[model samples]
Each structure stands twice: as C-alpha cells, then as structure tokens.
Target: MPSVGIEGPVVSRGLDGDGAVEAPPFGNANEIGWYRGGARPGAAGVAVFVGHMDTRAKPAVFYRLGDVRPGEEVTVTRADGRTAVFTVERVETVAKDDFDAQRVYGQHKRGRAEIRLLTCGGAYEPEERSYTGNLVVSGYLTRTGTG
Candidate 1:
C-alpha cells in the first residue's frame, strides 16, 4: 500500500492486502484516511483504491471523484519508487446500496494493469439515508517509471 504523512499525497498499491498504506484525502481536499490497496502500481492486475465521499456531517476526501473524465491521465506512484500512468477508459456511477462489490472489486482478464478509484455518489439521503451510490473512475495502465 501507499504511505503518506501529514503532507501525504494520493498514490496506489496492490489489492493483495499485505502492505501497510494510506490514501490521503482526494485531490488534497480533506483529512479523511483511505486505503490505496496492495497491487504494485504498474503490475498486471487490478489496483483498487477506496475512500469516503462524505461522513455524517462533513464531505469526505473523494467527493469530487465523479469529475474525472474519460481519456484523462491518472498517475499511480508506487512505494517501490516506480510511477505508472494510466488513461481513463471509463467512469461509472453506481448506487451505493446497489453496487456489487464482487464485480467491482473482482479480478479482470486484461493484460494491462487497471485501477479503480471509488467513493460515494448520487443524491444524499436525508432520512434513514446515506450516500445514494458510488462514483467510480476506472483506468488502464499506460506507463510506469520514477519520474
């Protein structure tokens, strides 16, 4: 997983659940802590990153995740000192209550590495309510390096 200090920035890792890491507030917008996963940034597999869009009273780090657009470039810097660049292929918003975690977090057959940035989405519920769904930014690995 990726590590961050008080000045921590967003990064990526494997979903294997071995590394001790933290995902800084999305876009450096807040202080909420999230997990960046365990997969090596550029490795051939799915790299999952999860964060809260908002808490009970305050907006969480990933509130603006839905703003990501297709064809946009996403960079995943690995703890091993390698950085991977991915091109966003698709962006989907799924209801938080209706999302199938297995299909969303499950494995993929693509040869290139894929990363999913997830957070809450849709209209916020007022009573017996919470986030309506999730905003997902899916991208395919395009490049990797230190710089």
Candidate 2:
C-alpha cells in the first residue's frame, strides 16, 4: 500500500484459542498478518489485514496506516499473481472497549470484495501500556488486474 508507505509479505494467521485473531510476532513487525480463516483477497467478502503501528525502537510496516484517506487506493498483490485494488471508503478510530467486531469486520457488500486495514491508534494509556482504540480503514474492491 504505497498510499500509506506499506509494503511487505502477508503472513497467514488464524484465530487464537480465545477466538481473537493472532498477530504476527513482535520480532516480525515489518510483516502484515492476514486472517486466513476469512475471505481471501479479491473474493466476495471482507478480508482483514493487521499490522503494528510501531515496534519497540522504531516505526513498523503500518506506521503510516492512519494517514490513508478516503478516495485513496490500496493495492494487494495476491500470491497467485493477481492484483486487487480497493478504494478507501472510510477511516475510523474505533475504541477498543466499544469496538463492534461484526461491524468492523463484516462484509460491506453482498458480492463485493472488501478489506479492512487495521492497527492501533488513539491516545496511549500509560497504565495499560496500550492504545485506547484501533484505526480501521475500510475499502472495497474497485479494480482487478493480473500482475
């Protein structure tokens, strides 16, 4: 996603025992994690991508994810050599405590291939050492090409 200065291989990930998606190891901060249990990119459902905003010492692959704006494009080059381009529809900062999992990760359209780029955002709470919310960028497939 050049629009947000993101470029890296997506490692397949799955849900943990508690049913929450697993994140890439902190050591691999430069890589993005894809929820493999869900719809594949360019398929007719929501595809999720997660990455870290920053590592302990420096910014990570999705450090600039929140900078992406509506109307901008996010391109995903699939492992099968096809490319799917999506147009940014909305960028939201959803509070962690108030997050709606279905709303944020649900398909936007019945037959459209959509995606959500997610990373931590909002004010940092020192006591918890965690962000207050998450940055969610929702987009739908707009173009496809064989790369």
Candidate 3:
C-alpha cells in the first residue's frame, strides 16, 4: 500500500482448530498474509492483512505501520486486477493479552467494506520471541478502480 510504500504477494492463511489465525513467517517480511477466511478487500466485510513489524536484525515491511494516521489512503490490489481504495479511520495498539477478538475480527457494519492492517507493536520479549501488543490500522473502502 502507498502508506507503507511496499507490496508483496498476499498468501491465504487459515485458522487452526483452536480458531487462531496463523501469521506469516518472520523470514517473509516483504510480503503480507491475508486471512483467507475473512472478507476479501472491497467486499462487504472486514478484510485482514498482516505483516511483520521487525526482525531480529532489521525492520520489516510494517515497522512504520504505527505511524500511519487517519485519513491516509490504503490501496489493495485484488487477484481479479481490481484495486480497492480505502481511507484510514483509526489506528490502535492493543496488548496481545487484551486483544478483542470480536472487535478486530467481527463485522462492524452491514454492507460496508472495511479492512484491518495488522503488525506487531509494544515491547518485544526476547525470551518469548513476540511483541506485547499489536498495531492495527482500520480502514474503510472509499472507492475501487482498475489495477
């Protein structure tokens, strides 16, 4: 997306039996992973895209995601060659422990196309090999165009 200034293949990620969505590998920092079970971009639901915030030695594609502000534009190119244009509505950082499944994954409004861009945030724990919080950017579809 323009705000992030990078783009890569978005692979489908499915939920496991525990109903948890698996994140992309750390080595694939350049690409984004889409929750295949969630709404597709430009569709009437929440489409989720996730990327790595940082690696052990360097920053990843979404290291700057926390800096994105409301009103910024986020564009997603669909497999059908159509572009889904979105306007950022809000940005939030919530602790992983307090992550609200319903708020993040639930549909906000009926018939409204929305998206969530997610990445790691807060303190990183070396022992745990994970961040304490998640950086989420919520956007709503503003328009569509040919890619």
Candidate 4:
C-alpha cells in the first residue's frame, strides 16, 4: 500500500439517516472512514473517504491532507487483500456554502477509477463546532498490488 504517513486504519462507515456519510469520530483522530455506498477504491467510479482534520485536542489523521501535491500516491488496502494505488491529481479547499457537488462527487471520467479524500478546513467556527470549508484531495487509480 502507498504510504499515506497517517495513523490507524480505515473503517467502513455508512450513510446517516439524512443520506449523508458520516466522518470518523473526532475523538479517534487517527482513523479514516470510507463511504460504504460509493465505488470501491480501484473500481470504475469515484470512491470517497472522509476524515477529521483536527479535534479539540489535536490534529487528526488527515491533518495534512491539504498538503498532498499532484502526482503524490495514495494507497488503499481492501478487505480482499488487494491494494489500490492512486496518484493525486489535485487538491482544493472549497467553502461549505459553495461546494460543487457534481465536481466533488460526480463521475468525471467515464471509465477511470477515482478517489476523493475529504476533511474539514478553512476557519474554525467555535459556535458551530465546524469549519467553513472542506479540503478535498482528488486522485485516480494508477496501479494495484497484493497486500
């Protein structure tokens, strides 16, 4: 697996009652969550993973997610013991109010496999206990291996 330089393993997380995938708990700052309804990491569609940038006490697993540059590698190990290697295409921080759902979650390429790593970013709003924007790292499948 491509080393992401983070702590903890990714766990499967399903959508909430509102049909939205929940992020990993802030208390468990090292864990990442994969959206169960999305495509598999190396499948022919976009797969999504979400995490927390930071908690009240410290930085989380994806705290440096925004630092990922184009061409960097991200590796995900599936339950079947296969690893999907993805190359970062780009990274952006979008305001929550102006988030483009289509670009963030829609299928961009017809048959290529893609992945999006998401986390809270921008200014923290203490009153709302949230951030004003989201940090998204977009990547595409580049290779695979047995893990």
Candidate 5:
C-alpha cells in the first residue's frame, strides 16, 4: 500500500495499470508502488509517479491529473514529516520512447525541487496498442496549497 498520514491522505495501487493507484496527492510512485528504473524520494533524483487516465471499465486515479493547469498546487508528504509541495509548471505530451526520464527526473541546475507525473495519452488503442504516448506534468516545490 502507499504511505499516507493519519490525517493526511490515502493512496493504493491503481488497478488495471491505469495507475488508479493512489498515494498522497503528490507522493512518488516508488514510495507507494513497484516502478522500474527509479529511486526513492530524497534519493538525489526526481521521483516520478505514473498512472492511467482510464481503464477498460473506469477512469484511473490520475484521471483528473491532466485537468491540472500550470500554477496548480500538488502536495506530497514524505515519511520523514517534511511535506514536499510542488507547483505545476508545465504539462506536455511525448512519445513513449521519446519520454526522457533524465530530462524529466534528473536534478535541476537551479537547485530547485521538482516532481513529475506520468500517464498514457495521445489517443487510446482498444486492444492492440493501449496508449500512444505519455502525459507528463512537471512542477517545482512550494508550500502546500500555494500556487
């Protein structure tokens, strides 16, 4: 299960790979689920969380993620009691192979905190190819609820 505070929020593994898997509003998937090629929070790299916009039967947890506009606020509570909040800076669509993990998850030169959200996008395939690309939401850290 994903980590959450007693009074904060709860997130669980999303079903159908749609990543309905929920964590704290902005928690990294690694802290909550099994993700390949990523490190834990505060591990000297940008943590990434990924989910699906929709499943065959229903929309995933991050279904509404794409609805978040730039300047929106996303709050993630770390296990250490430090809440790493992020402000949505940009949202972009990229082909699967073209999705650059380093560019998206690597540390920034400006020494600012950052986070990334990923999901399948760019047209849904019914049975063969499920998704065409990834919808990435990028943000930098800030105080919670402040955009």
Candidate 6:
C-alpha cells in the first residue's frame, strides 16, 4: 500500500488451534498477516489482512492505515503472480466489544471480491497493553493484472 505509506512483506497466516486468527509474530512487526483461510485478493469473496498499528517500541507497518479515505486505491500483489487493485469503499473504527466478525470479515455481496485491512485503534489501554477498538478498511476489487 505505497499509496498510503505502507510497505512490508505479506505473510500467509492461518487460524490457531483454537480457531482464532493470529497476527504476525512479534519479530515481524513490520509484516502484514494475510488470512490464508479466506478468499484470495482477486477472488469473489472477502480477503482479510492484519497488522500492528504500533509495537511496544514504535509505530508499525499499518500505523497510518486510518489515514486512508474512501475512493483511494489499495494494491495487492499475490504470490501467484497477479496484482489486485481495490478501491476503498469505506473505513470504520469499531469498539472491541462491538467487533462483529461476520460483519467485518463476511462478504458484503455475493461474488464481490472484497478486501479488509484490520489493525488496533481507538483509546489505548496501558493496563491491558491493547487498544479498545479495531480499525477496518473495506474495499472492492476494481482491477486485476498479471504481475
């Protein structure tokens, strides 16, 4: 996402044994974790990516995610040698307690190749060492090309 000042490796990640989506390891704070269990970037379904907004020491790869706005473009380079260009549809900040997995990760419409970028946001809880909400950026595929 060079358009928004985000540049990093995209690591394929899977669910944990408890079925929870895992973030990139602490060692890879600059990496973006792509959910391998969902639709591919250009596929007709929702694809999700997660990254840390900031580490304990400094701002991470997605620190500027919330800076993005609607109508901007997000480009994804797939491992399969293809490029997916998506246009931002919306951006939201949902409280942790109000985080709806289905609504955030679910497909907005049948056969639409959508993508979501998630990161921690809202009030930071120093006691818990985590934020009170998550920032979600929604987009839909607008173009595709061979890499």
Model 3: lDDT of residue 119: 88
Native-referenced Cα lDDT, model 6: 0.92
* Candidate 5 local distance difference test against the native: 0.57
* Model 5, runs deviating above 4 Å: 1-44, 144-147
Which stretches in model 3 have alpha-carbon errors above 4 Å? 16-18
Task: Tell me the whole-model lDDT of each prediction, alpha carbons only.
Answer: 0.63, 0.90, 0.86, 0.86, 0.57, 0.92
How close to the true structure is residue 137 of candidate 4, measured as C-alpha lDDT? Answer: 89
**Backbone clash pairs in model 2 (N, Cα, C under 3 Å; residues 3+ apart or in different chains), count:** 0
Evaluated against the true structure, the overall lDDT of model 3 is 0.86
Better candidate by lDDT, 3 or 5: 3
lDDT digits (tens) for residues 97-117 of candidate 6? 998899989888889999999
Any runs in candidate 1 off by more than 4 Å, and if so which?
A: 1-38, 55-59
How many pairs in model 5 have backbone atoms within 3 A of each other, for residues 3 or more apart or on separate chains, i.e. clashes? 6
Name every residue pair that clashes in candidate 4.
Answer: none
Using all chains and alpha carbons, the TM-scores for the candidates as numbered come to 0.70, 0.95, 0.92, 0.92, 0.66, 0.95
Cα lDDT tens digits, model 3, 1-147, are 666665678888877577767667888877788999889999999999888888888888888888789999998899999999999898998898999988887767778999998888889899999989998899999999998
| Tens digit per residue, CA lDDT, model 4, 1-147 | 134565558989998786657887777778889998889889999999998888888888898887788999988888899999999888889899998878888776889999999999889899999999998889999999998
Best lDDT among the predictions, by candidate number: 6
* Pairs with steric clashes in candidate 2: none
Error (Å) of candidate 4 at residue 87 is: 0.4
